[model samples]
Target chain A: MNKYRIVIEPGSENSNYWKDLWNYRGLFYFLAWRDILVRYKQTVIGILWSVLRPLITIVVFTIVFNKLGNFPSDSGAPYAIMVCAGMLPWQFFSSAFSEAANSLIANSNLLTKVYFPRLIVPASTVIVSIIDFLISFVILIGLFFFYHFIPDWRILFLPLFLLLATLTAMGFGLFIAALNVQYRDFRYVIPFIVQFGLYISPIGFSSTIIYNNANIPDYLKFIYALNPMVGVIDGFRWCILGGSSHLHIPQFIASVGISILFLFIGIWYFRKMEKSFADVI
Target chain B: MRNPIITVENISKSYILKHQNNERYTALRDVITNTAKSIFTKQTIINNSKEEFWALKDISFEINQGDRVGIIGRNGAGKSTLLKVLSRIVAPTKGRITIDGRIASLLEVGTGFHPELSGRENIFLNGSILGMSKKEIKNKFDEIVDFSGVEKFLDTPVKRYSSGMYVRLAFAVAAHLEPEILIVDEVLAVGDAEFQKKCLGKMKDVSSEGRTVLFVSHNMGAISALCSTSIILNKGKIEFNGSVDKAVKIYHNIQTTNKNQVYTSQGINKEIFISETYLKNSENENTLAFSHDEPVYVVIKFYANILLDDLLLSISVSDFEDRKIFSSEVLISKVLSVDKKFGEAILEIPSVFLIPNDYKLNVGIHIPNLQVFDFIENICSFSIVDNGSEFSKYVGTDIGCVFSQSKWAII
Candidate 1:
């Protein structure tokens, strides 16, 4: 007789979960592919929307903050370039986070009808963000050419910063996705988070403005670093706008530590709530 | 003997059914306010009602290799819950299920098909969602399209396809899946009758290849045709587990309505009233169970305070779903003189006319298209058992409820 392939009992889902995730990688890829395909299906703009959204944001922020407000670009990089650097990572974080937050409820039909790692649903939404990020990265390359700004060896670390932004988004996205399944109020809560997150994060202005100020206290700076995206935006500017955009190693470490902690917390809470998702959903 | 392919031991699942409100979702405000009320008031909230309803309780069963098992039950009987547990869609609240081979369950068809995706894209997307690897779907791609007969529309988005074509494409992809064990829950209920028959035929082909199949459906015809062994669930517990015939028999017994088996009319004032009604076999013995080859009679006895004329006595037989199968009527004046105060009517349903299923009998004596003198619906019920008929030799052949021997010559 063949050996027993699967033994299912209460909490058996925890055992071999990572291995099951590995086995179901095809589903992960297909789910991501499905979202990517459906994202731009009927729209005439199609993939161009990915490029246009961030470009328009960069143009509008440059006018409001750089041209009108006359904010000093201490990095010696063009004010528009500095804002573009911050805006790219911020766009990726906001969209990926929001998408991941609603991923579970959006795929509730699959949750009830099929059995695969529930983690795949939210994780796949991140791929959509990655594709959008790659598309919008083209605009930043265009800015580099227009400004004749030659990048240095430090630019090789851009992927590491992108990875940071992804981890940060996924951490909060998974937590919010699971919570949204039980309490639909989280649905209303997500747009508010994305909206409020844009202003608080150092997107329109530089983190250096606050860190360089003599009036702001150290404790306030530390609390600002607690927002994981603050580290991601700082990292992006350090890599892309590399003149005077200093990477604060101490604050960077603090932010990275919090992002990892949120990732674990998100996974822990997601697994805890995953068992009842099919039933409740 | 081959080892059991699936061993389920004491598996159970329960859900906390909240009766506080009809809302399916919780709001943060409600949770916060309820917490505040509970913490400060120090008294239990009257409106907070939580009841744990066990959908499956201490159920245990083992299925061997190459067995086609049908799970038959009324609604709310936990058949779906049991399938959900076995397939690992939802974990059982207690106990365990050990399976020896790859199992794919179809609680629904087209589970993750995106309407905006083309038919070809959805095939791969849905196949992977059902646990098929990409290479496996690619290998079976042509066969799936051929089976669905929607090859011409492969490039078109599925939203544009007709509903029939959509279901065909979905079911075709599912049929090509080569799992060692397949668990399906009423996915065959979709599509037209011919499509349903085709789906059942494909399922039989799957089981014939020595794959274990667990099927849950309310359609007894499909159940009897496909499954060799069956399990009957009642109120979240296994009521019976045995051959398909006996399982279906027990299922009918469980579904037997709350109406009195031997209906006795109340003394509602009328010119005439049915006093008693029941079913009897060919031997004139009172039996609710009858063989498919034997005649069953509906005996209704009524009392009239005054002589009546031109009374039409009708007996209608309906299947388990309450669909009227056929009705037989006789004019009391033509059969026997209605000048007497007491009269008895026996409607004989001939042998081999009704298939193996539970059927209800509605007896009424009424004027043509006018007032009902004495009428009783679902007065009695009876079942026709399959006792190794010639058609029983073949598996998965659904000869519908009504059958009769008609003269035929095949050259």
Candidate 2:
């Protein structure tokens, strides 16, 4: 009996897996298309549901938060525009999180039975969510015209902000997806995290509320920006609204640092959990 | 002719079976007691016993270009683990493996086929998964659809296809993938008989084109027909790695010897226990012997705890790989009288059906729709040595499950 054992070794950052991902890029497109098709399959309105979902969210938030709670918006931008801008990143993150968390378990048939780069699973979810983000962007443009808000040169940073939000979502999404393969409890915890994340992030209210309150110190303001979405939402508001709520340099720096930190940590944790995925999943 | 396509060294893999502890937080009282115990003794308070299982154990083999090798093993014998390590789906715990060419694996049918996608779309999707380029897949698109026989359903979503159609399309894409090396598991078990025959033919065509093939299957008949060499694995270790006939013989011997001690009966009425079973030559020669296209007989002795009625004698014949060749049940309701006394019964297998190969016999005594009285599975094993029969020429080698004598005239 030859006692051969496979010791757990950490994967190097420069392994061929990245190159494999590149080679399997066509698979990424196919899976993204499949996700889009499956999402609208057999529905009465089909692709309209993609635009209608976020549009309905904007209307409900405007009524409940703006009309009743009296939530303050940016200086000149209407409440609908502010909510739509905030909703963009929020929807992208939540949708990406839910999709990626279920990616491995949903594709257990493939994972257990086949040999492909496992990273393709979560990577495809991020791609699929980007399609949804683009569809919902039409409503954002509609609100932009209705509110009569003019763009600034800072609007060029919209792609940068979208990339940051994508990285953050994929970072956490990959880790949670791998963990959910073993500990099924993460499946139940993910929806709660997404819903709770909406209230904690400055989606419904403006980040200016944190600045105007005197009870908090200036140092705490820098710490508050550690939540990566604060800078993203602020950047979106700053870019789209073109108002006094400009990007705070410290908050932006904090956001960039935290986003990178999540990206690295998420990859590390996900790679650690990947070894057991084929068996347990 | 070319460089060795797959060079697998001493590769091994181990898996942790269970988690030891899952508690996130410990009580203060429990922590203080554990801390005191740890201070007094080197042993920890928590008894964490981890069980590690090595799925593959120091297996080393090399496959050359154009070589078709069949890997045969029972379940949990590390066959899939070895393939996974070679394909880089799972890293080997110890040792190393190097391959010189692109490898495509059909470990399971419909592996990357998204049900929501159309069959035409899934063809490109599965092709790319096997590492074929878009242009290559497009060039072979019509051929794939024609081979799968799903041209009418090309635009229909694959989720709507029956399992047979799905497997046909999936296998077509994988079989047509023009990789330098092809690895396939027991995916042939899913398709219908005709489709399975088509897959076997395609595999033969692939291997004949100077491409390497690594096949894993329990069907010894298929392995013997298709592969030039074969390896047999047992308990995560290679038991035999040589000629397909020799490997099949070793596998069958081990299987029969292992099952000789267990007895089980089901779906019969009478209460009886099969005391023992054995096979001998027809002349009472005392040694297991039979010739190709000759009658083979088995003798079963047993004692009945209670008398029974409507007794039926059933026997299942399987090849060296434990794949069932044929089965028959002898109902004694009309042909013969039921003997209520403790005695022996002899079953005879007629000639010219089973090909020249090793086989095992499973015998059972059952009543009509009541319960099994006495049953012995794999009770006796025998081998049919070939003697230059006419059917041997069509098989190319004495390597098929059935040997039927028929003449073909090209009129």
Best by lDDT: 1
Candidate 1: regions farther than 4 A off: A1-4, B46-48, B262-350, B355-379, B383-401, B407-411
lDDT of 2 by residue, B21-121 (tens): 44432234454676798779988654444468999988888778888899988999999988877766666677767677777787888777878789998
- lDDT per prediction? 0.87, 0.76
| CAPRI accuracy category, model 2 | incorrect
Q: What is the TM-score of chain B alone in each candidate?
A: 0.77, 0.66
Misplaced by over 4 Å in model 2 are A1-14, A218-220, B1-3, B19-49, B258-380, B383-411
DockQ of each: 0.60, 0.14
- Model 1 over residues B65-134: C-alpha lDDT tens digits? 9999999888999999999988888889999888999899898989999999999999999999998999
Q: Estimate each model's TM-score.
A: 0.87, 0.78
- Candidate 1, position A230, lDDT: 88
